[model samples]
Target chain A: MKVANEQTTRDRIIETARQLFLTRGFAGTGIAAILKEAGVRSGSLYYFFKSKDELLVAVLDQYKGLLRPILIDPVEAATNDPIGRVFALLESYRGFLLETGCRMGCPIGNLALEISDTHDEARDRVRENFDAWCACVEGWLVDAGDRLPNDLDRAELARFVLTVMEGAQMQAKANKKIKAYEASITQLRHYFEMLESRAK
Target chain B: MKVANEQTTRDRIIETARQLFLTRGFAGTGIAAILKEAGVRSGSLYYFFKSKDELLVAVLDQYKGLLRPILIDPVEAATNDPIGRVFALLESYRGFLLETGCRMGCPIGNLALEISDTHDEARDRVRENFDAWCACVEGWLVDAGDRLPNDLDRAELARFVLTVMEGAQMQAKANKKIKAYEASITQLRHYFEMLESRAK
Candidate 1:
């Protein structure tokens, strides 16, 4: 029972910090804010996380764990066509922008740009998140098979998709509009059409 | 001469803040660090700018001012072909990544993601930077004219280019390698080729 309570406290702290960090950014968010928002004392926070940086690591780990269930699975289930799945994944992001009024972006991407230069462990975790994202898209491209050009490098294309997604989110957030996001995705869709047309 | 000296001090502070903010992020950098690095006192900093946020506006304005000479002119001078100029502009960013070992990304992009949620003034400035960048590329796409399909929406394609550049930089910085950057450019190049081949 004690262990269960401890686990709940840890999870609560991580979840609260995740939301705070996502909206406020790692450097912009402070420990006091997290403790206050999480409804925890300083002792409880330090008990679970030795420092705020440690808490960041926990949040990242939680993000990694949630990627499949929270992010990929829902989108993947919405579309069965391999190429369509690729785009459905992007649409999920567009949905996020709409829901947040273009205020929130990809949590990992937000941190990737903000903390990459300062935090090694957090940076590596960000990289892993990116790699995992790319790998999922790559699988779709590979499954796309001859519908995409036979010579098409699936891995590189996946990276491009990731780039488009991240870049689109940045523009959308900056302008506080979905137009930039829509425009980029439209261009990406055009590129994919060209690729498919050139298929073997 | 006294006025000129004051102008020099202001420039120095803005320049130092620019570099620090680029590498460290706006939220991550403090006024003390900027004052120490720029060799200016608090009195001088406060005299010129009321707060750190004000300093950030000045830094953003400095970036906006330098866009023509430092960013666009060199690339424009290097290429007469409109399409080549677009690639050349991307190449300049590649050079930055290589020189900085991928530690720094687009200063405007970093700020766009970091400050868009909290700082309205900073967010607007970042949006202006993106608009300015997109306008330059849109000009090139316009100049390319019939060489690209007439059906191509030049404005949207320009946005995609910005997306690719910002996204590429994010990936490069996260991975601390140029491979992701190179891969995205290559995909963008391939997309361009398809558009040109389908030219009117």
Candidate 2:
């Protein structure tokens, strides 16, 4: 019973830290804030995470684990067409921006840029998060098969999709408007149509 | 002579802060660090700018002023082909990644993502920077004229280019490799070719 309780406390700390890091950024957020919000004492917080960096790793791990359930599954459920699934995935991001009034973007992308210069371990984890997300999208493009050109590099295209999503989210959040996000998607759709036309 | 010396001190402070912000990020950098690096005292730092936020505005404005000369002129001088100029502009960014070993990406993009959530004035300035960049690229696409589809939305395509650059920079910085940057540009080139092939 004590072990289970400890596990719950750890989970709560991770969850609270993740939200704070997402909304306020890793640099902008303070450990005191996380402790207060999670209702955990300093000893417990330190017991689970020796430092804020470790907490960041946990948050990123959670993001990696949750990518399928929180991000991919809903979009996949909405569409079975492999090519359509790609856009469905993007549409989910668009939905996030609308829901959040463009206040939040991809938490991983935000951290990827913010901490890449300062932290090595955290940077590697951020790269892993990006790689995992890219791999999921790559799987969809592979499932797309000959609907895309035989010469098409699925990995590169998958990376491109990731790029567009991150870039679009940056623009949307900065401008406090969804139009920037939509414009990128519009162009991406055009690119996809062009590729599909060339398919044998 | 006194007025000129004061302007020199102000310029020195902005330049130092700009470099520090680029490398350490806005939140990561401190005012004391900027003053020390610029060889200015706290009094002098405050004499020109009231706060760190005000200093950031000055750095951003300096970036705005430098874009045409520091970014566009050299690329424009090298390539009269409008499309080629776009790639040349991207090449400049590639050079930055290679030179810094992927430690630095786009200055505006770095600030755009880092400051968007926390500072309204800075966020608006960042958006303006993006707008100015997009407008420059849009002009190139417009110059391409009959080389692209008449029905093409130049503005949207320009925005797409910005998205790719920012996204590519994010990946490059995260992975600590130039390959990610190269991959996005390769795909962007493919997209450009597809558009050009449709030209009348």
User: What would the per-residue lDDT of candidate 2 be over residues B1-200, giving only the tens digit for each residue?
Assistant: 37535669889999999999999999999998998898989998998899999999999988989999999999999999999999999999999999999999899989988888889999989998999999999999999999999999999999999999999999999999999899999999999999999785
TM-score of each: 0.97, 0.98
Fraction of true contacts retained by every candidate, in order, equals: 0.95, 0.87
lDDT of 2 by residue, A83-188 (tens): 8999999998999999988988788999999999889999999999999999989999999998899988999999999999999999999999999899999999
**Candidate 2 RMSD computed on C-alpha atoms after optimal superposition onto the true structure:** 1.3
The residue-by-residue lDDT of candidate 1 on B153-200, one tens digit each, is: 999999999999999999999999999999999999999999999884
lDDT for B113 (candidate 2): 80
In model 2, pairs of residues that clash are: none
Could you tell me the lDDT of residue A161 within candidate 2? 95
